[model samples]
Target: MIGVDWGTTSLRAYRIGASGPATDRLDRPGGILTVPQGGFPAALRDAIGPWLAAGETRVLLCGMVGSRQGWVEAPYLRCPAGPAEIAAATTAIPFAGAELRLIPGLTTEDEGGVPDVMRGEETKLVALAESLGTALACLPGTHSKWARLEDGRVTGFATHMTGETFAALSQHTILARTSVDGPDVPEAFSRGVDRARQPGGLLHHLFGARTLHLMGRLEQAETRSFLSGLLIGHEIVAAASGVTAVHLAGAAHLSALYAAALARNGIAVTQHDPDLVASGLRQIGRSLGWV
Candidate 1:
């Protein structure tokens, strides 16, 4: 079976065996956003044509590819849903050589009743729930997610725009003037994390990135790392309030950063493979008797 995680900026296809890890995989920068109108079929063919030619008859996809902007809009399933619900909600798309299905996203509301949604991340949460049972999870990226799993079902979750906000502050705002791209600065990052634990809010804390630089207290190269720590620290303060441990998932670098911030908050961290989407897709496929 072929499992594809086609999101906005990247496409990852995994060739799964009857059991165990993926036998083969393909990675491409051609995400759904790059596919022109009526071009998804061609894009899929281009990426996994060889596997299909080899008689791979089943394909399951997850992520933004199922969004309204992707191939087909697989409507979201409400919170407190499990793999069974996700599998049952999978949306099928017409393809000649394979039975293709798109995993629907998940949605839940905050205390105030505003809705929160997640796409590709739900698959990972499903995989995590299968192993961890009941837990809190943090998936960090452009938009980070804080999800709660209870007995193999996602009870609720929240989104934080830390990465996106960091990008804007470090590249497009006045903060950019003092920031320079460089390797990670652990000291600066830790300092930022410490600052987040102080009394002032995020807005006031953000401006400190500049003032500290002007006062010759922060080096230009450290600005980026510091800003990242500050944002992630604030996110943890808000989202991880009562949790003592969190299952962290994402690219290695980002995961490490989040781990540090989380650790600073006295939270225990258990890192999970970023590619758990394959395991997730497999679980959903199993629920449908397609794996």
Candidate 2:
């Protein structure tokens, strides 16, 4: 079986055997946004062409590829959703002599009852259920998600624009002028996290980065890390309250940053492999009897 984790800017394909783990993997830059109209099928073929030729006919996909903007829109399932519910909601599309299944996203309300939605991450959560059980899970990226899982079901979640905000500020704003490209500075990051806990809000604290630089207290090389820390710190502080521990899934660097911020707040973190996307697709496939 072929498992695809297709997002907005990237696509990953995993070739899973009838049993055991994925035997091979492929990655491509032809994300949904990169593909022209009516080209998703061709793009997908190019990504997993070899696997298809090898007679791997069953394919399960997750993420933005099932979004309204992707090849076909797979409607979202309401939360508290589990593998069984997600499997029941899967949408199958016939393509290239194969039965392609797209996993639907999840939707729920925030604490204030405003609607919230997530794709891709739900699949990872499904893979994580057996290990993490009922717990809080965080997946940090352009739009970071903090989700509450109970009894292997996603109960509710909230999104934070931390990564997007950091990118905008560090590349498009005045802060960019002072930013330096280098590895993260732990001290600078820690200072930013500490500042987040002060009386002033994030807006006020953001300016402090400039002030510290002007005063010769913060170096140019440390500006970006400081800004990152501040944003991640605020994100954690706002979303992680009352949760004693969090199951983190994503790239190692990003997860490490979130782990640092979480630890500073006395919250424990358990990191999971970012490759859970394939595992997740397999889990959903099994539930649907497609694997």
Candidate 3:
């Protein structure tokens, strides 16, 4: 079996063998943006062609590759969606002489309003949500998502454009002009979170960073760290306001940053391996009878 978790930035393909696991796996950088409809076949060939075997391998994929902007659009399967529902809703897109089965993203309504949509993380979050009762699973990334789980099933969720906001502010806004990357000062981040938590002071506190830098209170080397803290802190304070226990999944460092911001605010959260996405895919695949 060929398993893939193709996201907006990269693709990972694993060749599962008879020995109880997937092996001979290959990973390559190929995002939907880099490969439009006309370019996806070549992208797939470059990533998984070497592992293909006629009639012996079945490929399963999930993520932005299922989005409208992808090689082929896969519509969302509405909620109460277990593995079967997701499989039943799949759209098959042929690529590289192989049939690629894409899992549908999810759509559900919540108190936050509107039907929330999620790709990639749905597989991972659902797979790891077995911990029992109304879990608040926050997947941190460029488009961070905070979802609700009940009895090991996804009920609803909210997407905070926090990471994207940070990127925009740091790269395009004034914050970018003095911000530095890399982990230099943890103190500045802690301070940023502190500022965001103050009552009715979030918007007011934002300007303080620039003021500090200008007034020579904060060093240029620490500006980026502060900006990261500001954005992450604001997000944590906003998203985690009422939730208690939570699971954060994604890149380790990014998760840690969120962990720090939320933990400081008394919200308990733990980080997990992203490989759970594959596990979710496998479970969803089995439910779909593909296994």
Q: Estimate each model's TM-score.
A: 0.95, 0.94, 0.88
Question: Which runs in model 2 stand beyond 4 Å of their true positions?
Answer: none
**Candidate 3: residue pairs that collide:** 16-22
The digit string of per-residue lDDT tens for model 3 on 109-160 reads: 8774677789877787667765545678888888898877777677777788
lDDT of 3: 0.77
Model 1 per-residue lDDT tens digits across residues 1-291? 899999999999999866899988999999999999999999999999999999899999999999989999999999998999999989989998899999999999999999999999999999999999889999999899999999999999999998999888888999988778889999899999989989979999999999999999999999988998899999999999888999998999999999999898899999998879889888988888877
Q: Which is better, 2 or 3, measured by TM-score?
A: 2
Ten-residue stretch with the least lDDT total in model 2? 125-134
Question: Which lDDT values do the candidates have, in the order given?
Answer: 0.92, 0.89, 0.77
Over 4 Å off, model 1: none
The sequence of per-residue lDDT tens digits that candidate 2 reaches over residues 1-291 is 899999998999998855777899888787899989999899898888889899988889999999989999999999999889999999989896888889999999876889999999999988887567789999999899888888888888899999999989999888999877898999999988888878789989989999999999999999999999999999988998777898899898999999999998889988888778877888788888877
Index of the highest-TM-score prediction: 1
Looking at candidate 3, what is the lDDT of residue 190?
84
Top model number, lDDT = 1
Task: In angstroms, give how far residue 253 of model 2 lies from its true place.
Answer: 1.3
